[model samples]
Each structure stands twice: as C-alpha cells, then as structure tokens.
Target: MTDLTDRVKQAAAAAEADSPPPVTDLAVTDTALHWLQSRQSYFTDALPRHVDQAHFMSVALSIMPALVKCTHESVHTAFLACARFGLEPDGRQAAVIPYGDKATFQPMYQGYIELMYRHPRVDSVHFGWVRERDQWDYTPTEPSPRDFFHKPRVDLTEDERGPVILAYAFAWIDGKRSQVIILNRAQAEQIRNKYSGAYKKAERNAKRDSAWHTDFDAMWAKSAIRRLVKVVPTSHELAELLKADDDADDTTTAPPVIRGTVIRNDDQADNADNRTTWPAAAEPGSGATADTDGGEQA
Candidate 1:
C-alpha cells in the first residue's frame, strides 16, 4: 500500500509537469487591446484622417503577439511611430521588428512613398532597382532638364535579370520629373556597412535576417530616396520620417522618447527644434495612388 501511494504521487507530479500552464491570465492580444483602448484618444489624434481608428486597432491587434514579446516601453514607442506616420504594422507599409527584448519601428520603402505623396507639393514618387541586364541611361545637364531612361529586360526571370547594379528614386512635381537620385551598388553597400548596426550584428552571427540582407533591393531604393529627400523640397513630416529611420539604424543609442506625439531624442535634447512633430492629418480622397512601376518584394 505504501509503494502504491508513492507511485500514484509520482505519477500525479509528472502529469502536472507535462500539462500546459493554466489559461487564467488575459491573452497578449486582449491585454494589448485593452491598453490601446484605454489610450484610444492618444493614438487616434496622431493618426491621419484617412486611417480610421477601428482599422488601425484591428491591425495592431493582429501583430500584438509579436509586439508583446518586446519590452512594454519599446512596444509603446513602436506604436507611437505607427500612429504618427499613419502606416500600418501589417508588414507592408511598416513593421515593428524585434531586436532581442526591444522592438523597433521600421517604415518600408512603400511607406516612404506613401508619406511623400502626403506632401502637397509632391505629385508622384517612384523607386526602382536597375539590373545588370537592364538598359539604363542617365544624362545630367547643366542647370536643368536631365535625361533618364530605363528598360528592364522582360525576357529574363527575376533572377536571370542578374544582380542589382543600381537603384534610383524620382519625384514628379508640377507634373514633371523635378528630382532624381541614384545610388550605385558600391555606394549602397557603403551606406549599409556604415549605418546599419543590425547588419553588422547579423554578420557577426552569420545570420541573414537583417533587412539589408533579406530586402537588399528595397533598401537600395530607399537609400536613393533618402538622398533625394535631402535635395528635394519636402514637408517637415517627411524629414522627420527619415530621422526616425536613422535612429532605428543606430542601435547603440537609447531609444527616443515619445512625448505627446513628439519623438524626442534624449541625446539631441539641445536641438529641441529638430524634434519630430505629428503632421496634420491628410485630407480625405487627396492621397496619391501608388506607382506600379516596381513592386516591392515580400
């Protein structure tokens, strides 16, 4: 009888150990929704008028599990960026990527074009990668009226098109191509090696998870667009968007604080005027249609 009792006790203990944890607590999604709902006004005020709160909440909830794995503060900062930029965390326009316990908000190249169109001055924006097999030409002239042309080879498969040799971004203003910027493969690599801390870390670990590795073409185009934004006239919001991306690239520094819709960098507190401010919501039906010249790879 003593032996049987001991055996039964051991069996019960083993079963308990093998069983899953009880579902007594609220799920990550539920908790995140509750938290977001509690601060609904804060997020709603930051979002552009075109993006409804209900839709944003649904998208946020879809990614809540991943966001919950990150530190609470980091999650808040990431969502703050999402709301302010009016980009969804749906992995298209923007994404909240996890770096160990911290999460960073990364706006996709599409997101850049989206915000560019929000500028009343911008008529259209386009970014494309030049393949080694593609016919490309650019002739820069004095003062104004530069010539540019590109014809990607249709006979070749995407891989057969060969490695990307160049990336370019162009913008139309007043119904004409007013600004153009191009980056060669070498220059794009230099920018990645210099500014992408994530790329460096991935190199050390022999991992190819960084965007620089997974989406080289997109990053290449983005680099060109980033350069174009500097020379072209853009809104304060567009400039801030670039700054936000720059901050994400520099992982060595502490994350910026989101103070009432402003992304204030603690290290740059002396330059308070350069802080990011929430842009006014775009007018309904004024958003520009996305350019279909090049589709961003998933």
Candidate 2:
C-alpha cells in the first residue's frame, strides 16, 4: 500500500514536469513581424562600446517601405560619406565605427559567454539565426561524437545536423534587439545550397506563425512540431516592453564580423546630424534580388 502511494506521487511529479508552466505568451513571433514592417532606428541603435566589445549592424542593405532595391554596400558607403561630412573637430567617438573579424568565431564564443555571464539580471535580448550552409564541410559516416567532430568534408548526410541552408538572422528576446546578431557564413557555395530548403521553410514558418496558434492537429498528435510562434506585440501592455522587430535592420541585421569580413568606419557621434535617414525601401537593389543561393546576405 505504501509502495503504491509512493509510485503515484512519483508519476504525478513526472507529469507536472512534462508540462511547461502554462505557456506564457509567444512574444518572439509577433514583434519581429511589426518591426519588420516599419523599422525604427532607436531599436538598432547601440550604446557605443569598445572595439572588442563592439557589436554592430553595418547596414549591409536596406529594403524600404515601397520599392524593392537593396542598397547595401553603396548606401553604407553613403552613410560613411555623411559621417565624414559631419566629422567633428571637438568630438566624442561615434556609436558606430568600422568593424571586422580578424579572428574567426572568437567573437561568437565571447558574445555567448558574456550573455551567460549575465545570469539573473537579463531582461530581454533579440537573437537571430542566419543559416548559411546546407552541408558540413565534411560529412560523418558514423554517429559518434567524433564523427560529428571531425566530419568528412565529403560524404554528408540528410540530417538536421547535416548541412546548413539559409544562414539568416532576426530579432529575439535577449537584452536588446540584434544585441548579438550572429553571421556564421562559410566560403562554400554548396553549403549554402544544401540547406536552402530548411531556410525557406523557416521563413515561411516565420510568416505563418506570426499570428497566434491555429492548427489544432499538431496539439493532439504530432511527435515534433516546433510550434514556435512569435510573442504578439498586442500582448505587451508596456511599449517599453522588449519588442522583437523585423525591419531591414532587424531581419537582415549583420554583425560587424563574419569569416574575416571587415567594415572600416571613422565617423564621430555628432555625425548623426548629417547621416541620410532614408525610409525602408521595397526590394533590394538592381544588383540585388532574392539570392539564387537562398535569402539575401542581408
């Protein structure tokens, strides 16, 4: 009798553990959609830091409200020219400066560590994903940890862990939006080609799931439905509440560094006075279109 009672208690505890605490609102999905519509510079604006601690969105491109032309490099160039024109004689350093990755992936781990360090005080941060490749440089024939570690550049598989598709990034719930925008790109074109399907699917899911949950079938029977929906902006009573945005800056937010990529800037803070504040465009540039490889590098 006592043994039966103990077993009942154990089973109840397991059931409680299995259920997540009452599904506290899906916030990520909604804000990203709105922010994607009308981007606000205040969101992307970072509080200037040292070079080592600097994380920036270099404005690789911009898709305005109406037409569709991605003015990435050239616009960024214009921004720089504006900065130069507005350079101050007696000035403070600018919030943004040129950025590049001299050491590959070092910033990634460092950024991750810093986030972890902020254990309990973290309010919100916006994390983004950019799937760059589809296949690993080397494929593993076995299922061992080492197989995963020293995977063969050839002989890849059709697993989620196989190749990356479209390396994309958007807003998330960290401290700030694009606070840690990660750009994990490789030099392999085939890698980008492989995961193209997954990225497209992700984009589609993002769009569809931007609203509240609708599909009832998955709640009942599916084994693995990601069921990821963005937290709705309407849910937040506080405009000050951390909101995920999907603007050109957010959806296509680029980190200062990726695979040794570098951006050089020498502007002062007062230069904001002269910077061109163009509204979000509709499409990418004449040279820019939906990347045949997958999503654009924005």
Candidate 3:
C-alpha cells in the first residue's frame, strides 16, 4: 500500500510539471509576445510582406505598457482586431484604447482614409471642419453642377478660428467628386449622442482622457466620413471595419471573446466547456485629426 501511494504521488507531480504555466506567472509583455507568436500563421496570411514578424512584434510591444492594465482577453482581442484591419497602432493610424479594464481597437480618421484609398475606384478622400470664422459656400445647383467650397481662416490660430459649425467629408472616384456629406453642430452632436458610448461614459464620469473629450473635431470628422461611406463605394474590409465600430457603439454589447488558447489563473482548473461565443468585432470611436503631414492627399 505504501509503495503504491508513492508511485501515485510521483505521477501527479510529473503531470503538474508538464502542464503549461498560468498566465499570471508571466510578465504581460511576455504573455503578449507568446500569444502573438502563436498566431504567426494568421499574421503572415493577413499582412503584407513588408510587415515582417520583427516589425509586427515591435508594434505589438510598443503599446503593451498601456495595455498591461487591461484584461488579458481584451488585449488579445484588440491585437486581433488591429491585425484584421492591417493598421499600425501607433496612436496615429490606429490605437488600442483602454476603457476601464477593457481594451478596444480604434481606427483613426487617417486610418479610414488609408483604407478608402485601398479601393481601386477611390481616387481621393477629404474631410474638413468648418469654423464660424471660415469662408464656406455650398450650392446644390449652380452652373449646371453642384459645388462646395471651404476655406479655413489661416490668419487666426486654431482656437481663434471660433467654434466649429460643421464637418464635411467627400471622396473622389475615377477622378470625379462624389456626393458630399455635411453635418452641422447639432447634427454632429446627435450622432455623438447616438453612436458614441465611450463619449457618454466619459461625460458621466467626467473623465477627460477619452479622445472624444480631447479631440472633438477629429471625432466629428470621423462621424462625417462614416456617414459618407454609406453612399460611397467601399471595400469589404472597410465595411467590416464600419460594422465593428457600430458594434462598439452599442454600450449594452459585450466585448468579443478571445478565440484560442484561453489564459486562466494559476488556481483555475482546465475546463473544456469554458468557451463563449465570439462577439462582433468591436471598435472605439476616438482618434486623431483627419489630416496630418504625409497623410493621403485629396
């Protein structure tokens, strides 16, 4: 009986040693690196050749410090979404924002322009904010053709340009301008109240960290382009991205579940039935300016 018990103890110890370490045992960066490495095939198939493994890893690590405070599953989902969009999360083209303990992928206005330009038919895309002091003109019918014009007051500083009254986005297809979508301040506020859960939460908590609070004009530009895409031709990828943003807009919806290699606590036991349905792609509606140096030209 004593010999048999000893053998059982030895077997159990060996089995425990063979099992993978719990997620908490590793540094957040190490765990993220491991997760990204495991998805090597996925990235290779999804990204262009110029985005090599080293470059991909560097981008992932660049933002891990900020992501460290977020839930592991949320981090994984954010990275997955970032990979799906093929945008770099350098806070310009795209960003991974942390809302409470949840991390959400946000595609910047520049990112939208980047994706729009990818379509073969798309020639140029432009978004601008109209200020009270700016010269603006729009004619639905004149000279046998519709025309729109906006010239920001260059003499005044950005703040001195006065409050923004409108936001507009238009695209060129086959070198011809498409229908322009313009949103007035009231209209833009309605859209924000309707589709921006993050903004609402920030308002409630009085948090100034959200881009919606910090970069209102940029978010307004994004809203204008989002509406413009409805009438314009869009790529399947862009459509999917828009849908993701819509999903994220609904505050009641849960964040997407990480698909594979579930990470759990050291004390937790493996359970085959722990899987949950993956939610729709989630996006946060906060990003930088619509135009920047080196951005795609109209």
lDDT of 3 by residue, 134-229 (tens): 998998775312578888999999899998898888888887788878898778778777878877877788874566776777777788878888
lDDT (Cα atoms) of all candidates against the true structure: 0.70, 0.25, 0.65
Off by over 4 Å in 1: 1-38, 142-146, 204-209, 258-298
lDDT of 1 by residue, 8-103 (tens): 777777788996432323465565555445445556678989998899878877776655445555666788788998998877788888776677
- CA shift of 107, model 1, Å: 1.5
C-alpha lDDT (0 to 100) for residue 193 of candidate 1: 95
Top candidate when judged by TM-score against the true structure: 1
Highest lDDT scorer: 1
List runs of model 2 lying over 4 Å from the truth.
1-45, 51-150, 154-298
Residue 159's C-alpha lDDT in candidate 1? 96
- The alpha-carbon RMSD values of the candidates against the true structure, listed in the order shown, are 14.5, 23.9, 17.0
